[model samples]
Target: MDTRALSVFLSVAETLNFSRSSELLHMSVSAVSRTIQRLEEELGQSLLERDNRRVRLTGAGQEFRTYARHSLDEWQRLRRKLGSDEELAGEVSLYCSVTATYSVLAPILETFRATHPAVEINMHTGDQADGIARVLEGRDDIAVSGRPSQLPQRLRFLPLLESPLVFCAPSADCAVREMVQTVDVSRADFDWKLVPFIVPERGVTKDMLDTWFNNRGVRPRIYAQVAGHEAIVAMVSLGLGVGIAPRLVIEASGMADSISVIAAPRDLGPLTVGLCSLGQRLASPPVKSLWDVAEQTYPRAI
Candidate 1:
């Protein structure tokens, strides 16, 4: 388990000479001997043959040599990787609600890819809570989530994008298209109507949506409720009732041609979104790279 001892064991095994291994590691010969002795004692077998002139491995030594060599090489690789954590050069895994992937994160990802050309990204799609849970459980390096639940002390949150909620309906014969009429905020130039809706099941953004609708004193038919934005976009494209989603969702769905924006009497208001990860996961280079991209892209803008 002691990597230094493993390193010493591997070195001695490589040259089959204690003196050369000690010289290579810049350690005293006695120290090298004691490390091997301790290793043999731990494994309950003698691992080296010692005479005055020549050194060789005992049968037990040969078997452990393979494991010891591999383990030492792996540990050294880990050290080198951790030491170079300042620059991005590995795969960054992330999770987000389908909408965030298209709306909130597309530009950030594009610029990030351009800047860190050697880095690769793996993205998973899920609901806000699932995204949060994925990152916390080590399934992802970071997650873009609209809601940060009562996270335990081991997790941290990073605020990212804030965009107004918007409703989208099929530009075709969607039922709610007739209800959308643009109004000048100060002048009240057009009319808006209440109808059934598609929304994320009760989370931060959902609560914001509810409050916005309630304050306007309009009752949504409260028909369909689902968890992901893509489904909402898909259903809306099929002429399913109205869907209230974050503005980014509409843009990212790539179905804009199939859907039209439904103007509200007032901006439903910007909902705050952000990134999350386990606090201890910050040391990973991939996480650091993705976090850097997110921070530079969405820095608490006004």
Candidate 2:
């Protein structure tokens, strides 16, 4: 019945850490635990399970998480509807990578804020790999992400920019460059497998690399599989290996002095980076307003 408790429960459910939830809520760990206990007692259901090692949601907890998200969204929607006539007002949680936060998200957020001054923008920045999952989990209203080969049916993507997916090599002499230069195999004999690659550990970047290599009938020799495009830049800058990342990431990395874009194979094409959100989320006023601004500001650069 207590919306505050429900909010606390959702935070804990998302993080799966009592201490983290407490910190996020600006409450003591004991307070967070008590709030969850009270909610569970009210519902007559065991919502979560905890051990010394970690915490996890029980089956009931998963069901309640969905309920809590909708309940909070509806509550906020009602408040906005009743509270304001001249201005639309509500919180919009957005997620993006560090690069996107400055590059793609900056202008979009600025425009959104100017239009809806009463609305709060709760922005979370992290690796691009986690962007869509954040939206799908109901944690973020929207996220900046690259369009995947097969987008989920529940989600919608609006293209913001097109950046070529290019292979990057160390600007200085490196083993990867040396190998590429020395391995003068004929077009028929060219073995991409001979070159070492530093690639993203997950997400569309990894998927793209997998597809590119598979289509070419060669498995790249991975020197490292890292989490972020920035990390790829760092690794490639050190001559650790060649890497593939969007031109946007490279341009924003500030490490362009240390890396150079390699001529990516023709099969590997440009990436379309943009905003992503659940179709359901767009129905919310704050989310819809921001989505409108995004559509108007960046009209499908692809």
Candidate 3:
């Protein structure tokens, strides 16, 4: 079992595209294919199902993926332990939304890079809501995420800052804006049922929104359920519907000029944005190095 082959297979399994894996690994597409083929031949099992349209992991591939992740983690851990005195050198995979790349991560990454120049940061940006799940699934070592109401026992959160959850409507003269304007949204008696609401599909913000609606006993007229706060802001900017999101995201979305914040009758508590990772993973030197740098950069109450 060559570690290099395992690395290539793991990359392909994660991306499910030979071309993508090749791009990430800096290998030629044919080389990546050869690596997977050799692994399949040696194991006597087809790890992937490939067609002209898509590539998917077979049942065996899924199982092998888990094994490969653990194997790679263990190998990295062993290397760090053996070279305890040497400067820490390895990769730490981080997941965050695009907004967080500049707003949340920029300063911390700057300080971390200055301290641990040898360590590599492999960042993947997407919906901030998926950050915690990605860390739990071993897809990333750490993620910038909002603290959930009920934190998972296996994970640890390091709070950096608080961003208020705000309800927003279109600033433009549109149907949605007109509906919002008809009622004084700051009052408890406001008719929420009449306003079409754009909501988060899932995540901490969604949980908070559900709680807010339940408390008011208002059955909202849902207009759409979208992923990512940036998308929520974009939709609301186009006068699609009223939406809920963190103020931090709304401000950074670049569409803030087109969106207007609504004064909710009740105070929806602020979201605690922070660094999240498995407790066990923090023991890894490279991951811990970055985590410590973040703690130092944002030294405040959790």
Candidate 4:
């Protein structure tokens, strides 16, 4: 089987758009279509379901995606092993939020690139909450993520820094801000149930927020359940509702000036931010090298 064809298939399988895949792979749309057609013909399977509206992966496509990833990893390993004893050279796929690219990964990537110039870093940015899932699914070799309460047995986490999970309100004069001002939030008797709250839809931050509210015996008035801390901050800045996010993310968000931190009666313990990867992936030189560089970059105890 041609590895190039597998690469093209994986690209299309991920983006689910021929035009986007072609742009990423630097191939023409027709060429990309032909490549997928050849792969389907060879395997006698319909890998993708395409219509004018959108493209979606078939069950076979999902399974083939997993297989293609492993095959590529093995092929890269073989090539490296057979090559001359030079610096490590291959691609390492990484996943993180847009903020993490500069706030968390900048220093580490700077150092890694300096040491391993030949290695390529393919980074994908999305909601920080999805980082762990992406790494576990083998969609990315590593991800910058908050440490989950229960670490998966197959994964390893390297603690880098800690950021307090903070509640924030809009700085602008709005109903939400007025409500916060009318009541002393630091008092134990404050009516949290009356305030509209923007919260994470899922992930560690959401879990922490749930525990915090439950422990306080207050069922929060949830206004919105959204993905990504950045979105939460943006909404809060517009005076939509009060929200919770890591202090690091709030500081990094350009709209920080528009958001005000709320002082709660009790603190939700700081969130530990770190690098996460499958234990097996760390065995790969490129992935391991980046992991090591990150550890050295943030050599502080969590």
Report the lDDT of model 1 for residue 282: 63
Candidate 4's TM-score: 0.89
Q: Supply the TM-score for candidate 2.
A: 0.87
lDDT of 1 by residue, 1-302 (tens): 59888868867865678888788779999999999999999999999999998988888987896576456445545866678554445455678776777667888889888887776575667677577666654456688876443666877778876666767777886446655433332223223335557777756667777776666665657658887767787888787777867667677778888887765425556666888887766665556667777788886643
Q: What is the lDDT of candidate 3?
A: 0.87
TM-score of each: 0.58, 0.87, 0.89, 0.89
Lowest summed lDDT over 10 consecutive residues: which window, candidate 2? Answer: 180-189
Better of 2 and 4 by TM-score: 4
- Per residue, candidate 4 scores C-alpha lDDT tens digits across 1-302 of 48899889888876789999899889999999999999899889999999999999988988998888778768777777798576677678899999899999999999999999998787899998999998887778899899989999999999999888888899999899999976676565778777898999999899887887777787778899999999999999999998988888999999889999986334678888899999988877789899999989998847
How does candidate 1 score on lDDT?
A: 0.70
Query: Order of candidates by lDDT, top first?
Result: 4, 3, 2, 1
Candidate 2 residue spans exceeding 4 A from truth:
80-89, 181-189
Q: Rank the candidates by TM-score, best first.
A: 3, 4, 2, 1
In model 1, the number of clashes is: 0
Error of 4 at 278 (Å): 2.4
Q: What is the Cα root-mean-square deviation between model 2 and the actual structure?
A: 2.8
Candidate 4 stretches with Cα past 4 Å from truth are 83-87, 264-267
> Across residues 16-100, which tens digit of lDDT does each residue of candidate 2 receive?
9999878877999999999999888988999999999999999999899888877877877777668745577656778989999
